[model samples]
Target: MSSKRERRWWTEEEDQILKAGVESQSKQIGEVNSLMSWNEIAAMLPRRTNKDCRKRWYKVRSDFIKGTWSREEDRKLQQAVQQHGLKWALVSRDVESRNADQCAKRWQHGLRPDLKHTPWQPEEDAKLLQAMDKHGNKWKKIATLDLPNRSSHDIRNRQVLKQLF
Candidate 1:
């Protein structure tokens, strides 16, 4: 059997060092330096592999945004969608603090003009339960195949509200 390495959380000091080292190596004119290997960066940190360093660098990127979308953000999303017509990465740049995935979800579920907002009926609830039983927490499958007009996020939220496993 192969040995698995136990995961270690990075300390603040380690993060600082990693950030400094990566920033120094990455900056060559305006783009990342292709000549600099992750192995070289990882060598600066104790017990961290090249893979770990690379993954961590991506995970802690300074530009990623999270949290609730605001009204202004919604307006920007709408404008972006109108301009770019579902080219989500381009749309994301126009909508501040949102990535392509966030923009897509917002448009598909929240901002879509044709999305229905009807209250869940008893028949729908029964169907949801039956679908959950059959699909085993695969919300997208349940949503698309079993419960039309419902998003995976909505299905998951409904399941939580009902305290269903």
Candidate 2:
């Protein structure tokens, strides 16, 4: 009897074949209830598994929604920030329909400088102190007045509170 070969990793060519096959099959299976299973797809592309095809399909969908930030995308994000003034949520939404977390992370890291800064301004400090003094640990109320734009609950636990109180 002949020896069987062990399965190996997929190559670029295999990936292309899998992509084409999935596209073709998906078109045919359109709107059908309980369409082709991953196992069937894998059988069609003998070298891969249902799991592999599923994973690749998920990755492709994610990439399409999140759109890897190209130089052009970065430029657009920057321009959006300049034009809209630190509307990171809006900019991120426009950049990619999915991966909002990824876009938010990019913005926080200064990969998107047009996003707003979260520095503690002196006026904010003063207002927080005043509100704290008046309310006596009423952080939520103080934050609303002192930093209306900020989520005050988060700011209540900052090191600045130690200095102020």
Best by TM-score: 1
CA lDDT for candidate 2: 0.59
Best by lDDT: 1
- The list of candidate 2 runs beyond 4 A from truth reads 1-8, 31-36, 61-165
At residue 19, what lDDT does model 2 achieve? Answer: 73
Query: What C-alpha lDDT, on a 0 to 100 scale, does residue 68 get in candidate 1?
Result: 81
Task: State the displacement of the C-alpha of residue 86, model 1, in Å, after optimal TM-score superposition.
Answer: 3.8
lDDT of 1 by residue, 18-56 (tens): 887787886853433334467988999989998787667
Deviation of model 1 at 115, angstroms: 3.2
TM-score, every prediction: 0.59, 0.30
Clashes of each: 0, 0
Check candidate 1 and list the clashing pairs. Answer: none
